[model samples]
Target: MTSQGLSPSDIASVVDALRELRVRSLQSRRRINNPPRLPSRKALGAVVEELAAALFPHRLGADELDDEGIDFFVGYTLDKCFRVLEQQVRRELQFSAEQAGSPVDGIDERAENIVRAFVSRLPDIRVLLDSDIVAAYEGDPAALSVDEVLVCYPGISATLYHRIAHQLHRLGAPLTARVIAEIAHSNTGIDIHPGAQIGPSFFIDHGTGVVIGETAVIGQRVRLYQAVTLGAKRFPADENGVLIKGNARHPIVEDDVVIYAGATILGRITIGAGSTIGGNVWLTRSVPANSHVSQAQTRSEIFDGGAGI
Candidate 1:
């Protein structure tokens, strides 16, 4: 204790404080008994990185592999990811069943089935991500090539994570999906909910401060810039004033629409196909197809310095 420069009393005090906090947490309903464990964020993040490597074996993968060995590398990576994801999925199912106080029978079989279905869709996910890469390359004049887009664009990284997380969310493993999404959000500063439905050829340029809410539906070839938020205008409350859980709240963005930076489109309103939403626009209502929406005109007047200074 002398060598460590901490007396026994210091350790005792810290332990006592932590115990008090633990007791208080239980009283506040924030701590509960240990049952089946939940999904691990660290393991989920590793699986996501492996999936990304497998999806783009040539671009986002290891540098040591040549073209001839790419197929083998991808296969090996996919197999490894499948095994890890299956375990996590099983944990998630068991935890959920325990929370519901339901029987955990057949959870293993269900988890295996979900993982198999998710793995089978990897090729489709790759195809969708290819379209996203192409969209990013073509939409941004500064982008040099598709390879550059894949390697350098934060938007692409965020979208790839969203695609994987969205698949997990659809398969009823939402906790794991959210963990994966948060990893990408932490890395890219772009927050996309795992439940958001995004279509092919989606391009988000300079993607900092971008937020896409849960239940937001976006269509093909849609382009959005930084600070764009597709959010809920209001929450529907019940008789007791408790906010409703699951309802259509975010905006429905149609195909070929472009939302500029700093724009916020709220509620369940639709942004029609081929429409353009200007920067910093605050929109609440639905616009017709092919429309261009922007803020109202502002008039500036000259002011004399002596007026109020």
Candidate 2:
């Protein structure tokens, strides 16, 4: 009720007027410049779907695939995938370049090269993906078959995409890598950056909320339960206290390591080979080889109150 201040109704009216002005300005700008069109995530997801069909036709598209028809099917799929993914990769690269205020030169050539290299490496990636399937089948008692794991398990699907996209990421095709990973993330709730180096025979059991940061190196035969985080403890800041990008801030899990659920091992530390990290543990320091980290054991509660409830 102060004389110097506006009433609540007046303030609300002023806010509404400003919102109307903003909407009008936005509509005018849209008419003038036409809203920028980005590629569809669903289209990118189709790329993964097609690539999966191409990679594992026998399993993913058994009814459609035959020994005699495989060559034609693969050829047709590759042709379509290359064309569609090329456009997506181009758009992603162009958008990223514009955001950075850089020129988007040689994008076509780079995308072509990326697609070619990725296709060529598909055979090898499939082998690794097979390893993952085998690992999952062997690890899980409920798994019906390798095909079941590949076709139905989100973890296996996410891992397959990660392995495929990791190659593109290493070949300096980050946009393509991002597209591939995003495809997996869309299909499955798992988010693994393609820049993370994961070795073969890796398994993600009940894989949800698993975050493996860029620059994290996971070795062969490593097993991760759900909610395991390989992240940075603290970021390294620049001169003005801004955090540096693309630094090696995540942990390294060596060969044959097992990280259980809800375990957070952070910050450039090495979990040496053949180690077993217990569930719900927080590890910030380096663990030596063949170490078994678990909670300190205590005597059973049966001794309390003469074994009564």
How large is the C-alpha RMSD of every model relative to the true structure? 5.3, 9.1
Best by TM-score: 1
Q: Which ten residues in a row have the lowest lDDT in candidate 1?
A: 297-306
Q: Give lDDT tens digits, candidate 2, residues 1-309.
A: 657888899999999999888778868755334344456677877887788888888887547677899978878987898888778767766766665769879988877877787778888988999898999999889999987888788899899889877887887667668877887877677789999999989899988888898889999989998999998888789999998999899999999999999888879999999999888777777878999886331113223456321
Q: For each candidate, what is the lDDT?
A: 0.90, 0.82
User: Any residue pairs clashing in model 1, and if so which?
Assistant: none
Which candidate achieves the best lDDT against the true structure?
Answer: 1
- Tens digit per residue, CA lDDT, model 1, 46-137: 99889999998777789988989999999999889988999999998988887788999999998889899999999899999999999999
Q: What is the C-alpha local distance difference test score of candidate 1?
A: 0.90
Q: What TM-score should be assigned to candidate 2?
A: 0.82
Cα lDDT, model 1, residue 145: 97
